[model samples]
Target: MAKIAYILLCHKDPDAIISQAEQLTAAGDCMAIHFDARANAPDYVRIRSALKDNPNVTFAAKRIKCGWGEWSLVQATLNALQAAVAAFPRATHFYMLSGDCMAIKTAEYTHRFLDENDKDFIECHDFFESNWIKTGMKEDRLIYRHYFNERTQARRFYTSYELQKRFGLTRDIPEDLQVMIGSQWWCLRRRTIEMILDLLRQRRDVIQFFSTTWIPDETFFQTLVRHLIPKTEIENRTPTFLMFSDYGMPVTFYNDHYDMLLGQDYLFARKISPSAHDLKERLGVLYASEGVDFPISGEGRSLHAFLTGRGRVGRRFTQRFWEAGNTLGPERELFLIVCKKWHVAKRLVDQIALETDIPCVEYLFNEQETPLPDLGGIETTLTKRSRHRRSVVRMLFEYFGKDRLVLCLDPANLDVIEDFCGDTAKTRVLEIECEYSDDYLIGHARRVGLAGENSPSETVARLLPPIRNDLAHESELIRGAGIDGYQRIREAADRAENEAAITEFLGVDADKAQAVMRLDYLFSD
Candidate 1:
C-alpha cells in the first residue's frame, strides 16, 4: 500500500468536496480538509457529516479565513498540511490540492507512479523574471505591503507605485532572501513538508515579508523548497492539471475539454466547475475505465524511464534552438510577434504563413546571444537568455522595414513592441486567438536573468532602457494614437484582407475585432 495523504483546501460546494474525497479515499491513503472559515458554517457541518463514515478522513481544527492573493491562503494550506501529517503519520507522500480538483488518475496508478519515482514534483522559478506575472507588478508584489480585510474580505495592497505617486516612498525589497514563485499546487515527500514547516518557524523575516506580498501561496512553499532542497531532489513540474485561459483565469472545463483531460497522465485536474454536470459524469466514466488494480507491476517503472529518456532525447534534438549559432535574418518588411508561450504561438504563425504565403519568422526572445536560425522560410529563433526586449527591438529595427507587421502575443511585451510599431502607419496588426495548451510547458520563454557571463551585456548597453524598468518609459506613440485608434486600424486592416484568410488563418473575426490591449497596471513599471 502506498501511504499518501492528500490535503484539500476547500471553500465552497460541500457536496463536491465530499464526492471528491470519497473518490480519493482508499485503505492506505488518508485525506485532510481545511475549509475556509469564511465559508458557510452549515456547509462545513454537512461536509463533516458526509465524511463521518470515513475513518481516515480528518479536518483542520483551526480553519483559516482565506482570501485570494493574501497571506491567509498560505496559512490555510499550511494548516491542512499540518493536519494531514498528524493524521497520517505513516504517509510517505503529501499532495496539496483544492476542493474543486478531481483525481484524474486512479489511486493505484497514482501510488505506483509516485512510489517508483521518489523525486519531489514542485515547480519553482525566480519570481521577478517569471511569466507568472503578466503585469510588470513583480516588483510591487515583492516590495509592497498587502493586507487582508476581515469585514469587507478585500485585499488591501499598498504598492510602491501608489506610494511613489503620493508620498514619494521608494520600494524596499527583502535583501536576505530571494523570492521564488510557481504553481500553488505541488506534490512532495513527507520529509520535505516537515522541513518546510521547520524552515517557516526559523525564517521569521521571510514569513513577515511574504505576509505583505500579493500572492504568498504561490511563492511561500516554492521559495522554501528551492532554498532548502537540492536540485536533484526537486523536479520543476506540478502534478495537477490546471487549465488557464489567455486572461489568466482558471478555465472552466466543459464537455469539449473531456478528451484533453483524459489525455493528461496526471493525478488530478483542478477548478472543474460544479455546474458542468454532464462533464462530471463523463469524467467519472473515463476515470472508471481502468480498474484500480489494472496490474502495472514493472510496466509502470519502464514507462516512467521511457518517458524521461524520450524527454532527454527531445531536448538534445532541439539543442539547435538554444545554441549560439549564426545570424540568419534581416527579412524585408516582415511580421513579428513577441510571445511567452512560443509553441502555442508557433502553430498559429505556421497556419498564417501557410495560408498567406508570406514569410514569417519567430525570433524566440532569450538571454543567450544565439545565432539566429536560417530565416529562408518560417523559422524559429530560440535562445536561453532572459532579457529579450533589447534583442527583439533591435531585430525589429534591423530586420523589418516600415511596411512590416508586428503582433505581440503577450501584452506585457507591448511596452517595447508598441515603441516600435505604435506610430508606424505602414505597419498592420492582425488579431488572432491562440489557445495555449497546458501540455507544452513554457520553455526558455521563462528564462531568469542571473548575474552570469551569458548575460546580454552588449544588447543591454545598446538598448539604453533596462529591461526591469522599461515599462516605466511612457510611450507617447501609443498615447497619442490612442488604444481605440490602434484597434480601429487593426480592424480595418483585418477587414481589407480576405475574410476566410482572416478568420481561418488568424482565428479571429474581422468585423467586430479588437487589439489585444491589456489594462494599465499590467504594463506599469
Candidate 2:
C-alpha cells in the first residue's frame, strides 16, 4: 500500500475544515494543513481542537497573509508541503488539495492507482510554447516587477506596474530557467517533491524571480517540475478537478448537481457548496465505501441533449447565432401538428410515420417522453432534467436532420410550439381545426395504458385543461407559421374539405392518405 500525504490549504469555515480533515484522514493518509494568516484566529483554534485527537493531521509551522495572485499563497503551500514531508517522511506520494475539495472516489482506489502509476500528475505547459495565460497580460506578467500586494493594495499595484513600464525598469529573466504555468492543483511522487524542495534550497535566484511574478503559485511548482523532471515521468493532468466559469471564477457544485458530479471520472471535486448538506452527506458515504460501481459508459445522449444543446461548435456566423439565440445546427424543415383533440394529432402522426418515408415523431415533449431512449445505464432522472426542456427543444432542431421531420406535441410544450411557429422559413404548423367529443382522449388514454390505475374520466379530467388552453392559441400559431386557413373537420358529416386541405398542405398523393384522411381517429377502433 502507498502512504499518501495530503497538503491542505484552507482559509475559512472551521466546521467545514474540521469535517473535511476527519474524512480525508479516515484511511490513515496523513495531512499537513496551512491556515491563511489573515483568517480569524478563533476559526483556526476551533479547527485545531476538533482535529487535535486525530494522529494523521498536522499544522504547518508558519502561516502567511495569503492573497489572490501573490507570492504569499505559494509561501503558504510551501510551508504545508515542507511540514508534511518532515512529519510523514515515508509518504510515497503528495497530493495538493484545498479545503472545499472532496474525494469523488474511494481512498483505497486512489491509493492503489497511485501505487501503480509512477509518473507525476501535474499540469506543466511551457510558457513560451503554450497559450496558458489567456485572460490578462500574457507574458507581461513575467517581464515586470510587482512590489505591492495585488489583492489588498490594488491601486498601488496598478500604479507601480505603469511606473515600471514608463521608466523601463523591466528585468531580464534567465534563459536557462524554463518558466512554465498551469493549474495549481497537482499530485507528485515523493522523489519529485524532495527534488524540487532541495533545489529551492539551492536555487534562490529562481525563487526570487518568481516571487515578483503575478500568480506565482500557478507557475512556481509547474515551472520547476517541467524543467527538472523528464517528460515521460509527467502526466500533464491534475488529480483535483477545479472547473472555472467563463468569467474566470470557480464553478461551485450544489445539491442538485450530485448525479452530474458522479457521472464524471475525476478523483476529486472542488468548490463544493457548504450548504449542500445532502450532497455532502452522500459524498461522505461514497468516500468511505470499499468498492465503487461506475455507470455504463456512452449512454444518456438524449438526456444530455435535453440539458445541454447539441455538443457541437458552430461556424463563424452561426456561432454568433448559436450564442445569442441558443440555437444549434443547420436550418432543417420542422412540421408541428397540433389539434383541439390530442388523439387526432397523435393518430395523424402515427399514420404519416407508418405510411410515408418521412419520420413523424409523436409526443416529443409529452409525459410519455418520445422514442424513450434507453436509460438503464443513466443515473439522472427526468424530473431533474425538466428544467432543461426548452434547451433540448432548441437543440433538437439541429439534431433532427436538415431536410424535414414531422412532430407531435402537447400544450405542455406550447412555448416551444410558438418558437417553431416563429421560424416560418423552414417550419410549418398543421392544426386540425375541429371540435371533437371528449371520447377521443378517453379511449386513446385507455388503449395506450396512459390511464394507469385511474378511471378514464379522471385521466381525461387531468389532461383536458392544457389541451383546451393550447388549442386557444391555434390562430396565432398557424398565423406565425404562415398558414392561411383552417382544415375544419367537425364530425362524420364533414370530411371532404378537411381531407383535401391536409393532402394539399402535406404535398402527398391523395392515393396514399385516402383511407387515413377518411377514418375518424377516435372511432377507428
Candidate 3:
C-alpha cells in the first residue's frame, strides 16, 4: 500500500481528533499527532486515551504555542513533518490537518484524488492587491530593520530577494502573482516535503525572519513553497470537502446544503458540524457510497445523530407569517426584514438601501417599540414594546399580501421564523443562510433577488445594466424638468414612502413599489 502520514496539531477536543484519525487510518494511512505543549494535562490525557487503541497512531514529543501570525504552529508542523518523513521514509505523501477538521471522503477516495490530480492539495487564499499591501509591516521600522536592513536578515527573508539586492536590482513582485496563504490542512507529496525541508535548512535566516514575524502557520508553508516553486505547483481549489473552526466546537452544517457539494468536483470537505446536520443528512443519503458514514465521535455526536435522523429535535425552527390583506399587489416587491441588535443591523440596512433600489423594512422582533424612520426612509428607533408582535405580524402580513416580497434579515430570526412557520409557504418566504451574521444574511438576500444567483460577481453584473439605464434616463428627465422635475420626483418619492403612494407613482402596485423601494433603499444611502 502507498504510505500516507496524517499530521494533526491538536489542543483540546480529543474525540474530534481521534474520530478524524480513525477515518485517516481506515484509509491505510499512518497518523502522527502533536498536542500543543500549552494544552492542559487533562486534555492531553483525553487525547491519549482516545488514540491509545489505534495501532497506527504515534504522538509527538515536543509541544509548541499556536498563535495567530506566530511561527509556533509552523514550527510544530515542520517538526511533525520531519518526524513523519523520517519514520515513514517511503510514504507517498504527508497530509496535514487540524483537530477540528473532518474528512468528507474515505481514505481510498482521498488517495485516488491525490493520484488523479498529480498535485498538492492546498486551498489558495489570496487577497486583493490593495488588501495585500495593507498587510505589510514594512512601515514598522523596528520589524523592517530587524528583518530587512541587514544582509543576513534580508537574505533570510527570501534568497531570491537577497540575490537581487546583491545584484543592485530592485525586486518587483508581479501583481497577478498573489500571495499564497495555503490552508493549514493540506496534502503534499514526499518530494515536495523534502524540498521544503532542504530550503529551510539552506535559508535558515528566512525561517528565523518568519519566526519573529506575526505570520500564520499556513501562510509560512505557503509563502515558502511559492517563493521556492512559483511555476511548478498549483493550488487545488476543490481539494477536500471539510469545515473547521479555530475554536474547538462541534461542527454544524445548517440545512441540507451539503447535497449542493456532491455535484461539485471537490476531494474533501471539512468543518462539518451538527449545525449543518440538515445538509449532511441529505448528503449522507445521496452519497452513502462515499464513506459518509464515518463515525462522528465526541461533541459532534449530537450533530451527527441529528443529521442521521436520530436527534431529539431539529436545529431549525419553523416560523409562520399571517397576512391580513393584499400588501404586495400583483407585482412582487422584494423586502428584507432586519431584526437584530440595533447598532449592528441599522448600519447594514442603511448600506444595502443606499447601494440598491430594493425596499427594506426594519423590525426589532424582541424590542417593545416598533421601528420608526426619521428622514432617510430607514428605521431609526425601536419603540412601543406592547405592540411589537402585533406590529410585526401586521407588517409581515401586509408586506406579503400586498405583493411585497419579505426576507428575514437575521439568521436567529430566520430560525425563529422557520420554527414558527413550519414548512408552510404562506407568501413566498425565503430563508437566508449566513455564517452567524446579519450582514451576511442581508447581502445574501439582495444577491438572490438582484443577481438571481448567490455569487457576488453574478449579482453585480445583473444590477449594472438596469442601473446604468436608470441613471441615463434620470439624467435626461432631470435636465428636461430643469431642477423642478428633480424636486417633484424627490418630493413624491418621500411622500409615497409608505407602501401605497410609492407604488402608485411608479405605476406599480404595493408589492412592486415595495420591491422598488427596497432596491432604492439599498442603493440610496
- Top candidate on TM-score is 2
Off by over 4 Å in 2: 128-131, 296-525
Cand. 1 Cα-lDDT? 0.58
Ranking by TM-score: 2, 1, 3
Candidate 3 C-alpha lDDT tens digits along 1-525: 446787888787666665667666765678788888878878788878887887778777677766544567788888888778776666887887766454554555656667766666665555332233233453231132223323334565565444545775443333323445545667777888899999878777666556654455645666556655544465644355543332433345445434333323454456555355455445443322454433221222222332244222335332224322312333444433332223344544454355445445554444424443332322233333222433443455454444432333443343334322322223322211112233443343343332222223433344355434433443333234322101112312442543453343234466555554453433222
List per-prediction Cα lDDT, in the order shown. Answer: 0.58, 0.70, 0.50
Q: Against the true structure, whose lDDT is highest? A: 2
The true-versus-predicted C-alpha distance at residue 282 of model 1, in Å, is 4.7
Model 1 clash pairs are: 325-371, 366-385, 367-385, 367-386, 368-385
Candidate 1 structure quality by residue, lDDT tens digits, 1-525? 467788899888888888777766743578889999999999999999989889789988799888777889888888888888888889898988987777666666777889888878888988877786676466666655666543354333333346554774545655755678889899999999999888878878777888877778888888888877887889888998776654677866655544445445567788788887777766654443456432211122222232233312111222133223322234423344433444444554555555443445553443223334444322233332222333343344455443333334443444434433433233333333222322121112113211112223332232222322222222222334444213211222333443444443334555421222211121111
Encode model 2's per-residue lDDT on 1-71: one tens digit a residue. 78888899999988888888888788778899999989999999999999889988999999998888898
Ranking by lDDT: 2, 1, 3
Off by over 4 Å in 1: 149-161, 164-176, 282-525
Assess candidate 3 and give its lDDT: 0.50
